[model samples]
Target: MRNRLNRRVAAAASAGIGMTLLLAACGADAIESGGDASGGSDGGVDTSAGIDCAPYEEFGEIDGTTVSLYTSILAPEDQPYIDAFAPFTECTGVTVNYEGSAEFEAQLLVRVQGGNPPDIALFPQPGLLQTIVRDTGSVVPAPDAVEAAVDEFYGPDWKQYGTVDDEFYAAPNSANVKSFVWYSPSAFEEAGYEVPETWDDMLALSDQIVADNPGGEVKPWCAGIGSGDATGWTATDWMEDVMLRTAGADVYDQWVNHEIPFNDPAVATALETVGGILKNEDYVNGGIGGVQSIASTTFQDGGLPVLDGSCFMHRQASFYAANWPEGTEVAEDGDVFAFYLPPIEESAGEPILGAGEFVGAFADRPEVQAFQLYMTSSDFINLRAQGGQFIPPHSELDTANLTNPIDTLSAELLTSEDTTFRFDASDLMPGAVGAGSFWTEMTAWIAEDKADAEVLDAIEASWPQ
Candidate 1:
């Protein structure tokens, strides 16, 4: 079924309609920034920035060769890549066999250890890229050509997440702004509340909402830590955003680079702060325990209730906009807006969670490089915008083609003023600490009343030497 969908999308692209048309025809709206054709000029990509990819001369390719790709992308969401890659295959005759992201990672580990890795791998987290670079020694140092390609397609900070020891290990493919706080305008108006600008303002607003409601009903926040294998990632985002604002970019960078311990005072304080919110009787929709055990699927579905006036706000990635109630009109102009997670205090900068997809190559073949460059280029952005399968990472991409409110708002926040975007803390942390111990410890802290000190100790113990 997945292969058939890919072939159909490919056939359409080959016929020259592009993916954007396919998306619209399928009834998926391409969200655009600000609802205006101008495409949010505030902090958007500066068209003057020049990134030249002419340095690494294109290499000749051997026909009939195949490149195997492993990814965690679901079939429906991955249709775009399948469709997009079909063109590359036709142009270079290099067939691509893609697999699920989770299965890909597990299999890739075995293959690398056994000396038979794929030509390219699409890792979801930067931590995985770090692991591959440190373990297999098969990943080629991101060449000058790739670096130039990144600069051309994305902003300067774009490639920072995948960089290790001043060398890049992957190409950024999909990105979700994490610093956003989603809320229904109708709910806010019904509650007679205004969007808070600063962190204190947001807290004060939460307090007001709780005070007015009294019981656990009509809560101000909706939190779910229930993704099956990746359960605690949502909680991690909340902690990371707060930490970034509390500790400042310098300290946050240290934590990400493993220069400081994960249980450092700064990180601990951040956890305690989030815990306080979870513990608050009126803050979260179902209270601490309710949130702790709530299935991630339920948590995602909880957004509709917020729109129905059951909760006031949700802190999630920009992607959640897609899950809005079926009939809920996301602003007639197709703009989905999210508040920047207010500063924890009167901080100098507003911290945001940067989450997105990245592309990496295991083989240094010319065809591979060409496909990488092309996929991340303006051409692909235009194609994706038309298809509604992706949101553009490059600010310069023609957003006029986008109509989905979530996609449009995500692009808007990418270049919004006073916003400081940083990668998710866990993604930057060592995998064991980020994906394993952190989730387990945080969940335990929330549901089991684990000692704060004990939680801190557990996280500290998990830090890589």
Candidate 2:
């Protein structure tokens, strides 16, 4: 059934109608669902769409090749990427097999070291990519064509994210705007509240919410750092967001790379700033309870209180829209929406906190290289955008193609000429610190009510030597 769908979609693409059609018009072809994927003969190529194959043609014909891709994007989110690449398969008669999982980071390392790896893998953090590059040296660098496309389509900063040892080894695929706080617009209007324009204003608004509580029982902010084994990630995000605003990007980078100690006074200062909110018994865990409850509330349910008017704000990423109740409207005037977490007036520059995934290949086969290059190309980017919920790093993306207003705004912020964007700091740190101790220690500070200085000290002590 999927093969027939792909054939129909390929026909539509060849006829130049696929780019503007709905997602169902180009249902993603699942290579794994087909029988004996490796036994397929070359399907006919379709150039009727008038797609300029000039850029991809140099990789030579790879009519029967099958390329496997592994990623952390998972199920529904991964489908859009597969659909975006359908034209690649249609043009070259190559099958792109894709698998997504929550354990991509650990499993990818195991696969590479065990002498078996996918043709390509998408990395959510460059630090993990660096570890694999430095340790196994098994990953393939981006082809010249891919590098050139990245240079032409994305900002230099994004290119830097994918480079290791000064070699371009990966290409950014998807991105998320992280510095946002969700709130109920109608509730804000009913309570005569306005969006805070700066960090100080945000705090002042928090105080106002507390003051207006009928019995002084309602808090102003809600948060959750609980995410199972990855529990304290949300708290780490607060520190990173505050660090960019309080300590500036240079020092933030130093902290991530350990050029500055994790226990440095600047780091301490950021922790305290986070404490002003997360550690304040009056500021968090609205539906969940006091500050301690933040550690128990699942991250998925963290922001829900805002919808019930128990909390005024919930700091989270743009992708948190998925956590909202189905059929709930999410927009500036809808049930709930987000605003960029306002910048601090004292910061060195306006920095936006964000995260994204990078595409890297384990084999340099022509088919693998062709798919890699195509993944970041403008055509792939445009099609993915049309398929919905994709924010490509390509500087030239047409924001209008993004289906959601929030997503379009995120794209605007990321590509704005004056905005200096930084990837998630913890994600860029050594896993022992970024994914391990940092998560555990932050949870201790919130759950055990540990002192700020003590928590920082513990994390600094845990930094991998």
Candidate 3:
């Protein structure tokens, strides 16, 4: 707790947000400084009064070693990760060089197959991680210390994400809640409507919104899957959310691995379920044009209509907070907020669909191993959380320190014992099917009014033969 307090003080100073006031906001009782505040050569960097380096001592002085990291998390979001591990360098003399790219998924495979993998790579999808492990046999397993930390800090479900051929190789680093419906609280209040708690209630509320606005001048939902080259990714998220609710996790898992065909009856049902909301002209592209307008509307602008009363709900992930107009307050009681999308009545359980990053290594050098251990530590995770926009999967995270209400809500959902969690399945399938066919076909279905079965069949046929 003392270390976390000191990190916040440091962060506040860095951000120019007045340390004293920030401390007061986060309820930090005191700040502790250690000897030689400028940091010492023996100790990598100046740390809080009592942060122990004994756990990392076994690696035995690899200060000159430079460990490279590659990831899809680009600056400035990636800088927090670099800052979180600065202490590791100060303590052990190992240099951590991180490189992030928008082209991470495509570039990562090329690098590995070309025999140029980084010392460590942060993968946004376990499916991609597994592919590298299977194809190149280059990924190093997490050292025993890191594995133990995984056991102590994270839930069992997280381990499965990093395991390949029964060997634990990576740990989930950050997470985001994907099953949220964003809306304006003031709009709901003025319309005399309550946040729905079930799939049935959600549809009924959508119906009521249309009936309340007879001329169809207003609509119940606004949506977009257009994201430049990543255009139809949002549609894929919708299918995964519905699949989790309607087909259950076990079936979802099978479908992800192609244990079941991509166009199975269950998948068809999930696609149609999404269509009920997205294809219904009365429920989609509000403030824009008809349902066809969604394909041209950028995903970043899809949810903005909620604030203007042109749309009632926008289904998006927690990180969509970044897209809300600059001055908007996204509090539970503020003008706009998000609610957990409800489950289908016949669903097996309340399954939460989300996404996160995993840390995988290509080298097993002692400094590399030591860095991996430190990166996944509870202390480092909490420090990253304080930087905001970073959500740790650690069950031990102090949610009170997480300043964003949306982040806190995501943490609460992730930590709940009863909530079943599943990674975004589209990201878990073979890239040919997951990224290529799935994304392309979904966009065609929405933009061109293609048949659901035809879209699903194209995706199924495109699965790597």
Q: Give me the candidate number with maximum lDDT.
A: 3
Task: Write one digit per residue (lDDT tens) for candidate 1, span 360-399.
Answer: 8877777676656665666555555543435656655666
Model 2 lDDT tens row, 117-159: 9999888777778878988999899999899988888777778
Against the correct fold, how does model 2 do in TM-score? 0.82
Which pairs clash in model 2?
14-49
| Model 3 regions more than 4 Å off | 1-51, 93-95, 213-217, 415-418
Q: Best candidate per TM-score, number?
A: 2
Better of 1 and 3 by TM-score: 3
Better of 2 and 3 by lDDT: 3
In candidate 1, stretches whose alpha carbon ends up further than 4 angstroms from where it belongs are 1-66, 89-95, 102-111, 114-118, 142-148, 211-215, 286-289, 295-299, 325-327, 332-337, 364-367, 387-392
Q: What TM-score would every model get versus the actual structure?
A: 0.76, 0.82, 0.81
